[model samples]
Target: MSDLIDDPREGANEPEFTVSEISTAVKRTIEGTFDHVRIRGEVGRVVHARSGHLYFDIKDDRSVLGCTAWKGQVARLSVMPEEGMEIIATGRLTTFPNQSKYQMNVQDVAVAGEGALMAMLEKRKKKLAAEGLFDPARKQQIPFLPEVIGVITSPTGAVIRDILHRLRDRFPRKVLIWPVAVQGERCAPEVTRAIDGFNAFTAGGALPRPDLIIVARGGGSIEDLWGFNEESVARAAAASGIPLISAVGHETDTTLIDFASDLRAPTPTAAAELAVPVRAELLARLEEIESRRISAMRTALNYRGEKLRDLSRALPRVDALTAGAQQRLDLAAARLPGALTARVDRGRAALSEASGALRPSLLARTINSARERSEDRGKRLAPALERSSAAAQGDLARITKRFDTLSLAPQIDRRNDALAQLMRRFKQATEVAHSQRARKLDALDRLRLTLGYKATLERGFAVVRSAKGEVLTSTKLAKAHAVLDIEFADGTLSIGAKKTARPSASVSKKGTQGSLF
Candidate 1:
């Protein structure tokens, strides 16, 4: 007013400002004060623009500030902005002086220390470990023939495909899929849920319980694979009664689930390998055992044949000893003294009668009569004596021959008897061999029961199955796990169930229950 010029309707002349003038003055003031500065902060709200500009917010727990990088400046950045990463951003401060708005035009960026993220990971790992999630005792052994294998992974990812391919190639067993999110914010919860679902199914008896469960994912950054290391997922794996095989990330990377699970496989293929025995190897082993059995039986038979040969060779020696004794008996019979005495007695009797009739005529008569009688007796006795001697000689010879024959016969009889005895002994030996064979067979049967997969099936202990025909080994596969098939001695049953506490009797096998056929 002091220097005012008179205007129409008593108005005073005043200085007017243009938009460009105000804007330029504010912009110059902001450029002068801040020039260039660098601030360290956690990156947040980072956005990449379609036109190559980058917009972001830098934050601490208590505060947030906006940041931007133009296309030209963005090209110069050496590192990408990641959420929760502490970084140092070099930029000049600029102001929208009209509205008094302020932001940093980021020029360069570098990583700051990652103390907070490390602290969080360490805390979680400790918490989970303290809760026994990594205890070795919590692990379960994987089934040899996993009728149904459960897999938890990103459904559409390469991890799932890899697992499927490996499983098919190795085992070709049935798989029960519990599709889960394997990465991102929701991954931890989904993995935990899948583990829980598997547990419930194993415990309850609806879906056949997976004999083994596989939790697998492809390789990724620590943050991307963090879900497997989550306390929730680890605890769920620990709690699952069914065996779990963890396959997460690369071979070098280990997660919390690896400690919590029954086994840790470097890749999905390794998981499948751990879950099943190699079929070819098993078949080879069976063939080897059969060959060994056949070899053993052949060896047994050969040994028995050798023993029989030894027995056969000993038979003739016993017969020879018997023949010599019989020869001595025959010789004593041929030289008898009794026949000599009988001939001498007749001559002595005739001499005594001649002496008793000593008168000459009487003597002559006696002598004549004695002589005639003697002649008559001699004539009769001559033929008789000759016949007797001949008979005695013949009898002696016959007796000698018979004695020799008898001795030999006895020897032969003894040999024959020994042979019979040997036969009996052989029979006994064969019986012993048979008894040993029976014992071996029984032992083999017991071993078969212990080692054979079907032994348990025969023992009235049937594997429960799901409606989909997968064997249920545990309760983790069902919401309310139900027994589908009841395998019996004769056949299988499609059985419905009720809650009964009484246990069923185990299957008794006819072959093993003291029955030899």
Candidate 2:
């Protein structure tokens, strides 16, 4: 029986084992042999499982290797595996007993080399570009001087220091640092969150929304700055409501963020410079503008004053205008006295003639006697007097016709009165138009001041917001957030400080993760 048990065909020489036992032995052998290996192959057929596990194939020309990355491992991957990409995967080889298959337990994945990385980056770029994420029309114009600036970078990096120093030298501005990982897998996501957070601020928050954003990193290799090349980071940049400046790597180092950003800076320090103008230069410019405005106002006033003086000089004096009328009145008065004297003399002479004619001696003389007397004294004088009496009797009869003519002096006076009425109407119309235009300009200036948001902030009010920048209007909302930001007229203050202030970190931010491989 022992000889039978030791038979080669039965168990001893060939080895006898159950399926589970054999699988275990194989798993151990493979795991031990390929433990902590660095394998390079082209990625193929990637599957992102619903349970946050990853399954994929990596192959050379002839052989294929299956790989698996757990949920935890996925987070550490520098670049997720994509089909046809050449990658260097670090992990251990293992076998599954149930499926009778061998695979790699991948801890991380990286593009095989710079060439492969560049190729992948180029592909991603093309894809994002096709979606119009890089359109210039989608870009916001950078504020000439941002009141608040949000910076995303590593908390501990020299990049932040350089940025701060440069900003201090140029124009000092309020900066809110969103600490993040500037590299590694966390970099892209962290940067994306920082951008979203800045945008989430209440329009009227005490911690006001950033007018500008800067995504900055110091000079580094392409591999070191790979986080900025992420599609998510690029998309976030494109979607930013605030104007964004990208300052990743050195002057020659380019990333997808640079393309999507409103502006691109060569370095982190350069980005600070781009964010604000020189303080002294701005002050000088403002002073010059104020001076110009004052000068222009003074010049206009002087011109108007001189023009008014000229008009006044050209106008006839009140006394001069009345002089002609006064002289005419004087002449009329002088003529009136002389004419009255003449009229009195004529009346007396007429009365004397009538009295003489009515005398008894004259009346007693008949026409024949009067005629004989006239011929004796002066027949011509008597005949002439009789003829003049006969003519006056005829003229009196004729004078009874043709009455009702308007006099010249009264007609001329009416014409002058009508002219005066027209002059008054014209003066009123001109003055009315001038006043309306003046009011319109004044109203426009008033409207500009009234509608400005800065004017409202200056009124001693504050806006309550969470550190994430969401407006917390009530106590309940405030309770949900660990930290709070209060925006004041001058600046922002943080309360219930959950996140301690720290230096910068590598760029990265928040969201429901989709796929890591």
State every prediction's TM-score relative to the real structure.
0.41, 0.59
lDDT of model 2 at position 281: 90
TM-score of 2: 0.59
Q: Where does candidate 2 stray beyond 4 Å?
A: 1-15, 294-318, 328-517
Q: After superposition, how far is residue 63 of candidate 2 from its true place, in Å?
A: 0.5
Give the least accurate 10-residue stretch of model 1, judged by summed lDDT. Answer: 508-517
Model 2: per-residue Cα lDDT at residue 127: 90
Q: How far is candidate 1 from the true structure (C-alpha RMSD, Å)?
A: 36.7
Report the C-alpha lDDT of model 2 over 1-517, residue by residue, as the tens digit. Answer: 6866644554446767898888888888988888989999999999999999999999999999999999989877878898889999999999877789888999988898899999999999999999999988898899999999999988898999988898899988989999999887888999999988998888778887889999998878888889999988999899988899999999999999999999999988889988999999988999999999999999999999999999999999999999999999999998998999999999999999888877777676776697788778885788889999999988876665433343566777899899889999989998999999999989998898889655787897678788889987765677678778888889988877344344334433342221111
Predictions in order: lDDT: 0.78, 0.87
Those runs of model 1 whose alpha carbons end farther than 4 Å from true positions after fitting are 1-119, 202-205, 308-517
lDDT of 2 at 320: 96
TM-score of candidate 1 relative to the true fold: 0.41
